[model samples]
Target: MIGIDLGKIFKGNLKEAVNVVNRVKEEHRSYLYSGIGRASILLFKDDFEKSVAFIEKIPPSYRDFCYQGIFYETVMHFHKYSPINNGWDSEWDIAKVIELLEKVDEKYKSSSCFGIGRGIMSFEFYYAESRRYLFSDLVWKSGKALEGIEASLNGYCFQGIGVEYGRKLLNYFFAQDYFQPEQGYSLDNRFFSEPLNKEINRTLKGDKTLKGDDRENYYEGIKMAVLENFKDEKVRNYILNRIRERERSSGN
Candidate 1:
């Protein structure tokens, strides 16, 4: 079996390795398209060098997934895009897969990388949103992907992301197709609301100009303004729950 140690071997020549992986993807398209072959089996069966080669081709935006230390997850990322387009848990290999997942959790739990999410879901920046698509094509394409691991990503990966990109994501609400007459799309309000609220809170907290309740009142007013898009107070309250959900999602 290829095992996980191959990450070190392939690191020396990533570009050449990527070319080789492209060969596997192109040469073995049929293997990927078949029902039984869709599992990680096809990738696992490949030569170690070839598997690593395929992995090297993953986008630079997903650089956080490189084989530096988080090797298995790096492998899983490419596996998603490889001929084997799905995960496998056959009795023979299920234990190995479980071991890999535990490793993934451990690695992410202690690490801190602000760009990790934009790296993992950067594609979402341009094309997909996890809430809309259960898993964006880009997410599955990464193979080793997961959503909001350990809640640590809130500050490091997501909450700290660029406001411009965040604004683009928020722009979806203004779209004719997304904004409904019945406030049906209120669920999406937090995509922008949370960030805006966070910014408001940050500014208010830091402002020497506004003291005590003055700052608190200013922050509250900004939150109410965000609710302006929702004519119905009930819907606005529901859509604006993200601020509260942060702690819940974080399990704090």
Candidate 2:
């Protein structure tokens, strides 16, 4: 996984950082099919240039079967919206993000496999950008949208790119407090996490009566429990670990 240091960005100008993210959002308004995850990693990182350069070295034709358009779109969207300078601008930051994405594309094409490396790279970039605007109001809005998408995507893909991407999104949302205990808003943690847990329990208990919001609430409660209880590990990691253990025991 590509790790990002968000604490570094918080020491700088937070307002300006959020404004830049908002700019990117406005530029890529057309491509949004669902909510985008907001994370500190997306906002700040000193080694952004190095990260971009490394990913850019990859060819453009590479295909990320796991995330498909997600990798490309995320980079392009951020690049298109990022500010050239810390000041103001009507133009897009396409040059920088595109350059890096091109490298990602190349690397994927060379490997002939959609490795997690590309996804990690994209995530690092996103996190760095997001960190800069962590305290901004935009984070709340974007974070919620991201959580919604994640919950919606769950159970659709068991393994492979879809699952990986879903996990990333979940982690990002968790980090940003999108799943805050009892926080009201579209990004409320209950929407996805709680529902999944309920469904899992229902399946285990052989309870068919639990459906819709009831099942969703059960999952939400589980998510809240995990978040509240697990302070050291990330929410995604906790969930994935359980899934892995279950699969192993079940011989799946």
Candidate 3:
């Protein structure tokens, strides 16, 4: 797996890393591997323009698998380098980000892409609206949608969605316990919360009780629900511990 030590690269001056990434592109290679690496370099540099440019050049066939990896690395880099209290700093140009996302949507279409597309769409939606949407609307609304797509996609989709829900749930918990309800801390609460519960219900509907490894999906769904309902550090640690436990058990 191709990877970069983002922590090491973005430790000091972020601009220096951007320069390094820009310099590397002079090599003139445009393979999927090269695109992935270059995209990482641009993201670390916080050069959204360069990153989007590089990513847009990649063909659609390679994009389904590759784009998610690139986006995950970008988010991870931002989380480490420019985080706010519970979220990343929105320093990059939103218009540029939106434009890139539109390109991503067009290139990948909606069919045969499944989790990766949903994952990108989720993050983009969160970034655009400051809240998460229901998994069904995010993953299943498009024409010619994939069936059983959630099970087939990478665990990252579930994990990432869990993290976002966790963040929002913490916000809701904090607001109810301390802040004013009129403040709208759980902005878009209904959109995410309702479907989250519905997913758990659907998973266990009829005779399909969550069992064996299938239990993980149910747990992930529950974890997201809990994340939406709590925000304390204790709750955060507990949820994270549960996720780690599941990962270890899965041997992934």
Candidate 4:
């Protein structure tokens, strides 16, 4: 709905669209503002900086939401290239987005970063064609590894990954190719454990004080993401072992 309106109102006239959104009541502008952010990208598809400048023109109250949309679209753009053959091509997008994210106010940075994580992993599953391709090879290969993102935003990013991962696991009908029992492709332990383990490891190492309930909450989200879909003992146990190793190291 917001997208439809944006497409009609934003037909090469950013100021006209901005003026219209500015007049909309504050109570109903969040999604609309985010849509405007997405529109900025689409309108300035040839120039990333122009998109950023357009987002800056939005009111401060809603600018972060626009930034969140930008984060998502930027991530999608970054993943378009094949990780194996086009590794160098995508790094610039990540680096530039991180620089853009750093400019977001602290209050909004968490949400924006979370959007990036969710946006990236959403495609990870979207690109999966079968059980052998159950998870994103790009993610597993560290092609879109978010090493450059701020450390404090790690929890939100993990939560974003958890949300998409959990949702994907539940799509038994829609994603039968990846979830069906008879696919004969063993669900590799790395597919489930490696990314979660890697992020948790980085989080703890970067901030050891991120322990107890605060840390466990993120781990629990990761656990719940898979617990329902993975009933096999080996798969469940493997995830537990990986998490437990980090849990013990963190003195949890």
What tens digits encode model 4's per-residue C-alpha lDDT throughout 47-152?
Answer: 7777777767667777777776777776776443353333321332366667677766687787677667667666655655332352423233222456688766
Local distance difference test scores for all models: 0.34, 0.33, 0.39, 0.58
lDDT score for candidate 1 against the true structure: 0.34
Question: Per-residue lDDT of 163-221 in model 1, one digit per residue for the tens?
Answer: 21333333443452344445444435764445445433332222233333323332343
Q: Which stretches of candidate 2 lie over 4 Å from their true place?
A: 1-106, 110-160, 164-196, 199-238, 250-252
Which pairs in model 1 have colliding backbones?
A: 21-54, 76-143, 76-144, 77-142, 77-143, 77-144
Best by TM-score: 4
Model 3 agreement with the true structure over 126-213: per-residue lDDT tens digits: 5534543332332212111212333444344444443333444444434334545454434246544344334333322311222344
Q: Each candidate's TM vs. the true structure? A: 0.25, 0.24, 0.30, 0.52
Report the C-alpha lDDT of model 2 over 71-125, residue by residue, as the tens digit: 3334434443333334221233334433333444443332211222223234433
Each candidate's number of clashing pairs is 6, 32, 2, 0
Regions of model 1 farther than 4 Å from truth:
1-112, 125-132, 135-155, 158-168, 176-241
Ranking by TM-score: 4, 3, 1, 2
Q: What is the C-alpha RMSD of each candidate to the true structure, in Å?
A: 16.1, 16.5, 14.6, 9.7
Candidates ranked by lDDT: 4, 3, 1, 2
Q: Give the TM-score of candidate 2.
A: 0.24
RMSD of 3: 14.6
- Minimum summed lDDT over a 10-residue window in model 3 is located at 138-147
Q: Quote the lDDT for 75 in model 1.
A: 29
Candidate 3: which stretches are off by over 4 Å?
A: 1-15, 18-154, 176-252
